[model samples]
Target: MTAPPATPTVAVRLVPGPGAERVRVLAERAGLRCGGDEIGPAATVTVIVAADADQALRAQRTRGPLLFVCDTVSPEGRRRALRAGAVVVGAAELTEAGLLEAVLRAAHPHPSIPYPELSGVLSTGTRPGGPPAACTPALTARQTQVLRLMAEGHANADIALLLGCSEHTVKNVIYELMTRLQARNRAHAVAHAVRHGLV
Candidate 1:
């Protein structure tokens, strides 16, 4: 007998909020395949999208993976979201593909990134149960812009076009950002940026 196709691992929950329906339509259009609670095994990751951060918080049940889609996230809101262990992105400029990519990362994290997947670098405790090592390297303005775009789920090429620069320049800036953040990869850099509220 042939094996059946596997169900998608993550269960996505789009919270009701301003522009949420639009975002949901994008996810659907992007063909973001996901499993739900009723599937074979319960989904390990839960991606929640909303225009308001509080909508996400109210919708969260446990410390599962949260994908906050909003226009702006306040410092205090960022702090609260970090405490809740969430990942965020700016919704105003989101595209279907951007949303898809972010969801995929939240669902199936890159091995290069630190565990407890979405936890920021400055969690109250360290990895496996503590905080990250002290790391506050200063970043250049270009690097900060790149980091913010990266956090918003923009790829190097996209960043380049959006910033009116060459893709090569974008890559170089990202390299500098990764080094400065002491991040292993792009996703890691974003996590650090989010946790530190640098972006």
Candidate 2:
């Protein structure tokens, strides 16, 4: 007698490029049905396309999450995408796997400690007990090091190289960190760490 869990919704706006079909295919594989073709807003993820810098900027101003799939990765393109409020940007040549990963990440941002949650914890500070059990345990020294680099937006491959570990190890650490923090995803977890002064 429990209600079914809501499926995450993703909106995909086709940017001017040859890869629109490819992007759509990737999204479908991720269990995200097309927006207009399926549902409406009030959905968790909205995928929008910005064909050019101008459109991208406008999309950003609207304060909606965007996916900037461009034909090139020029500095100007990157700047425009970021300015357009894209949390992730990709190129036409980007592999389906890469684009899908970026989209998934954008769709599921990490969970955060809301003011009410923090307030409740702090107000009950130290009580008769030594200290309230840490809601998020301090990351191990190594995990802390990895998280700092992650916060700087380094990819797993780059982080692995920097830490002299395998990319798999970096991924594992990231997974563990997210699990411990109950983060919805990596970006959210990083934001949470930063907000909590954990990293």
Candidate 3:
């Protein structure tokens, strides 16, 4: 039988600017080829520019699976970037390893939101105004229950017991949640869910 073709690799786009050198170094360290030209059909794009709000806005419009690295981005700036299509945003201080990991995540999101500690559990019932800020359509009732338990500091076993399900089932749910949220890890998934009111 013929073997299947290799999947296309994610292309990396490096935004132009004084900080471009640093981005280049990071990309090299990660073994990712640098596309010195404008954004094209790359699976991932990284924008390195002066730490300015306007630059952040421009970077946000580049393409899918985008990452913006700079000194600091305001909350509004982050929101704008997210709205524009950036999957990750951080300061230049973020380590090359961290940036590489973030790129991998943007390329292949996790399967579920990280479970929160039991102490952090919050009510999932709809609030007076509407649904709790962190509940998204992507999350099933079981996944939400698992997330709530995680927030409360419950481990997978504990969550399984609380929900009367198998530990393996709980793990699967968490995986699904992380993937649907496009989170890199449990913490990021939880934060993303909370930020978007899709927990």
Candidate 4:
């Protein structure tokens, strides 16, 4: 008789906190075998739940596929993760199934966004309109301003202050822009804008 396929083991290297406990439960629910803090050869993917990107970078010393989860990361933090070849998934978008998929994706290794809102980033390069335009969609005047500020690596709060709007408004604008451009995050949106010469 043929043997059943082996379930891949993921290393949950989260700091001691409620987040760590939650990840453990999620891993079990996903039917993924999870290992302890020590990430060695046995681990197919190392899942790190960090409070911020700095913590994620610190945990990235382990040599293997890594899935980094954090609340939010700065532009520099994103660059560091990209340089380290670690996949970053926002904590808000992470789930049991998502975690499992992320682990599998880490094994394959590709630049893709895990969030549903920006999932099209890697697949579609054209604007939302019917025909493929010479350039990406033309950003509205407000979006242009926001994109410029974002390209400058300004945080949401700082952008809001500069634009005379609330932080929430800045965040909403960014979300909309990401959805329109299929951008993974703030840094990605800025990159897309720059690539398409919109910024």
Candidate 5:
């Protein structure tokens, strides 16, 4: 007789709040075997939600795969999470489908990355079998901010409002990111930033 498929375990480390309830609902909807605050040894993925992502990352350090959910994450935070062995870092706005995908990728991570799977999270527009592209210089602080907002699907007007800048400035940042990254458009620029973990 064939053996039954193993159930995947997901440990959700969220405080007792609105976000915790939402995460629980979503994880159940995704058909994941959801657990509580601590990521058990049998846990395939750890979903951590914290206002301070670094704190969550630190706590989840030495785990297998981790997905961090936060309102905002700086580039430094991204590096810190990666260094601490997180597989994917995401915004609080990630859809249920997106969260499920993150969990799946964490279960079967990329071999080259060795840390966590980020290709799906970042979505760099590279053709299969081709070398991954690199950002020639580095993105400025403002550009990083704008690109991060873009990743969240914010429009120029909304980005302007959030950044306390003019629409023109937002447009300029998008244009510059596209040009610098050789991206086809704003979405591509955001994808590049995501793939590179710059945002």
Candidate 6:
């Protein structure tokens, strides 16, 4: 695997309490920009501070790969994290090196995190060259906005904020776009959009 094209900017969302300070200090010490609560449009990775499984799960609605520093994570939480493309790092095991490594792996997804249903059917490159617009799917303006924001690495909540709509609207738009693209999930939808230049 290759490293991310650029040094990723990490968004750290803290669970309010004594441990919050510790996370702040650790992130700063590790040279990670503490992009507080609000997820940035350009955020390449995310770190969510959680005291336990529930908190970790609730704090992880953001997009892209994420690292969860939690005291304890349940099996269900692990499954959800896997499906969401996130890693759960036990708080006790957290370290400067570990944090940095998580950030690195987040940028370049590790093979251990399986790409479900991809089946080696995927290819890379953002250059538009699928089918002509006339032969491809047509996207609504809202769908286009959601797809573009998702492509630029914004979460649903961030997309809602950027487009001045509710998260429900964003989800509906994504569902609609995914249906149109015949995609299995958000990543697949974005990939299909890029491949077909439907965005």
Best by TM-score: 3
Roughly what TM-score does model 5 have, to 2 decimal places?
Answer: 0.46
Candidate 4 worst ten-residue window by lDDT = 122-131
Model 6 pairs whose backbones collide:
none
Please, what are the lDDT tens digits per residue for candidate 5 over residues 155-190?
899999999999999999888878877887765565
Ten-residue stretch with the least lDDT total in model 1: 121-130
lDDT for predicted candidate 4 compared with the true structure: 0.64
User: RMSD, model 1, all Cα superposed?
Assistant: 10.3
Residue lDDT tens for model 3, 80-162:
44444454445555666666655665565331222321122234333222234355445788887887677666789999999
**Tens-digit lDDT track for model 1 on 1-199?**
2222223565466655577677767766666544445433344445566645666777776545667776776545555566456665668878776676666655554312334333343343332311334545667789878876776667889999999999999998988889888888887787666555565
Clash pairs of candidate 4?
A: none
Q: Is candidate 2 or candidate 4 better by TM-score?
A: 4
Q: Write down the TM-score of every candidate.
A: 0.47, 0.42, 0.52, 0.48, 0.46, 0.46
- lDDT (Cα, 0-100) at 9 in candidate 2: 54
lDDT of 1: 0.62
Q: Lowest summed lDDT over 10 consecutive residues: which window, candidate 5?
A: 111-120
lDDT of 4 by residue, 113-188 (tens): 3343233232243333222355468788888788877766578899999999999998888888888888877766
Question: By how many angstroms RMSD does model 4 differ from the true structure?
Answer: 13.2
Cα lDDT of all candidates, in order? 0.62, 0.55, 0.59, 0.64, 0.60, 0.63
> What shift in Å separates residue 27 of candidate 1 from its native position after superposition?
0.9
Clashing pairs for predicted structure model 2, backbone only: 11-47, 60-84, 110-188
Backbone clash total, candidate 2: 3
Candidates 1 and 4 compared by lDDT, better number = 4
| Candidate 6 residue spans exceeding 4 A from truth | 1-18, 37-39, 109-199
Q: Worst 10-residue stretch by lDDT in candidate 2? A: 123-132
By lDDT, the candidates rank as 4, 6, 1, 5, 3, 2
